[model samples]
Target: MSYEDAFAAMAAGTDEAVANALELFPSEIQTISIDGADHLLITPQNLDPGLANHLLIHVHGGAHVFFSPETALNSSLAAAHAVGARILSVRYPLAWKAKFPASRDRVVAVYRHLLQDYPANQLAFYGGSAGGGLILSSLQHLLAEGTDMPAAALLLSPWVDVSGTGDSYAVMSGHDPVIDYPVSLASAAREYAGTLPLTNPGPSPIYGPIESGLPRILLTSGTRDLFLSDVARLQRRLIDAKIPVELIIYEGMWHVFQTSTGLPESSTAWRDFARFLRTAWAID
Candidate 1:
């Protein structure tokens, strides 16, 4: 099937669509609460009981507008199972209800809470699309406060630049079937930030400085994705800062293809994510 067709099939709806897409991967899902907010914890039922010490904190992608922790439950579970780790999927406040600093603050708070349970060295941050943006933004916020960062980070098709300065924003415009247009993304970012600068490091992390000693990052993107250039440029900036980063570019794929675990691309991406998690955390 073509990229357009694949995206159309995946964009149907978060609950039914995502659950159906991830049915092939088995995960144990449960509903829980964090910091007074409801969340979903997804873990592979067959995970080695001994490896539960390792944990992955996942933020779901919805362009900061759609989806919820329940929407990404299956994928998070599969990833945790794939790496034999536990998963925490945060149901963060959305752009429409809570704007900048607010949304970013909630995520940072959750990360801080997680640190209370698991050592920073044993935890990893995982997110995709807008969630990817959140992960980077949260790290910058924590680092500025001298807080501990995660051991590593995994970002899939990250929308790093809220400024939308990426060359591929126009180059891949028509080629990317999932994202409607750059205007829509920009509008959401503007609304999410309210009066905050679009280029603010905590708002658009691609324009921000990489913190020294931050966690190593594994970034994945597709050539056809609208955020391709943003991902590439972020990687370049990270490398220039002497930060450890691994980038994987999938040919002809669109944003967050791995969310569609039914596809071969999604399967490969998850396998890579699992391996990266194990290596980053030094899981035996």
Candidate 2:
């Protein structure tokens, strides 16, 4: 089914959609309330409690309308296992219910609460799809609020431009297996933006001026991903602003294709993320 059709089905009965999505979640993961927001904490089965210094905050992607933290735990689990770090996945409000800034603020609040126990330097933020845009926008918010930024950010197939102006959106249409053009991202972007302009830095972060003190960013994309323009533009902007950036493009892959387990390319992508995290923390 096309993304638009899937979204229509999801909107028809959000509760059922959410319930079905949760089936993908690992049963062993623990759900907890953090600062009044729902969060899923996923740890390796053999993880030692004492080895909790390194934390990865995973922001899930559902085009701002579909999955919750619980539903998207599979991706977070993959990341945690790959990096050998604990994953704290945030469950923020969705756009269909609360609109743009609510979810962004929730992320900021969750990060602030985490800082009380974990140092900013010991934490990294990882997100894919819409979650990737959240990662960038949240960092922009953190900077504006004068809070210390995290050590690094990992963005997979980041949808950094809500404006739907990217060239790939036009050319990559049949080539991209997942995204379905103005209907998929653009419609959801309108719902999320609400009263705000799509180009508002708080929404479409690619439009924002990258300033100093932002966290090191590792952005990955595939040649066939519709969001390739989004990632490319953000990487260029970061480079222009002198921020540390690692850009990886998996040739012939689709959007957030690393979520597919067992493929050699997927393994390489996950390893890249783990390596980036290790280097950020000086992990041997």
Candidate 3:
């Protein structure tokens, strides 16, 4: 099979898994069009003052390749349930189809449109895997454009440095079962970057300057996650830039393991996540 064919096959297989996963989170989801792009608006019954009238902008993951629009909702299921807020999950185009900055720019445009409807203080970002990296890079663009930032962001196993320069890439080469570096992410990263360099910082935020103008952030990853190095490195970079950041490393977990709603680790992680959101929003 061709490369695109293989990606499509992977996506088709993942779609079923994601669909099954969605059933685990009982939320009312509605699909709306934002500037002609699809956005899934999800609302779970649980309510929190921290999320009252607040919006969580969710970016979904698939290494910029796999995962469909429906699967995007599944990726943010934890956030919808934990945050107990209305979430607008942007259905950014896949990198294989739209190229490097296309996916990044689509997310920014959705954020920009949401800004007009909600105050920056009432908006925050939540994403995992590639979505996490995308959120970081997109915020960099926002800072460059002098745009106001949201209150907070939470990333789960974000692949911030797609260049595969981190220690985890080498150390976890034989460990991380979720991703095989040479066979998986390495190729996907290149496909996502398209004509641009992998270390462009626009796609790989770890190489970029993590300056001010970013919101308070939280990042979570598993010890066995291939992106562990990415999250750890970015945590230090954000701290060096004086950003209020928090990092949590779960024991014996893999990349984006939080998506497995049935896992015990996932339960604990989402509970911990709720606490952070409450603190960030000063819900008390």
Best by TM-score: 3
* Poorly placed runs, candidate 3 (over 4 Å): 2-4
Hey, what RMSD does candidate 1 come out at?
4.5
Q: Could you tell me the lDDT of residue 172 within candidate 3?
A: 86
lDDT, candidate 1, 105-156, per-residue tens = 8788888888888899888989999999999888888888889888999998
The TM-score of predicted model 3 comes to: 0.94
Model 2 CA lDDT for position 247: 97
Q: What is the lDDT of residue 181 in candidate 2?
A: 66
Candidates in order have lDDT scores of 0.80, 0.83, 0.83
Tens-digit lDDT track for model 2 on 230-260? Answer: 9888888899999999999999999998876
lDDT computed for candidate 2: 0.83
| Per-candidate clash tally | 0, 0, 0
| Reference-based TM-score, model 1 | 0.91
Residue-level lDDT of model 3, residues 62-173, one tens digit each, is 7878765576655676677876777888888887677889988998999899898898988888888899999999998998999999889899988898888888888888
lDDT of 1 at 220: 95
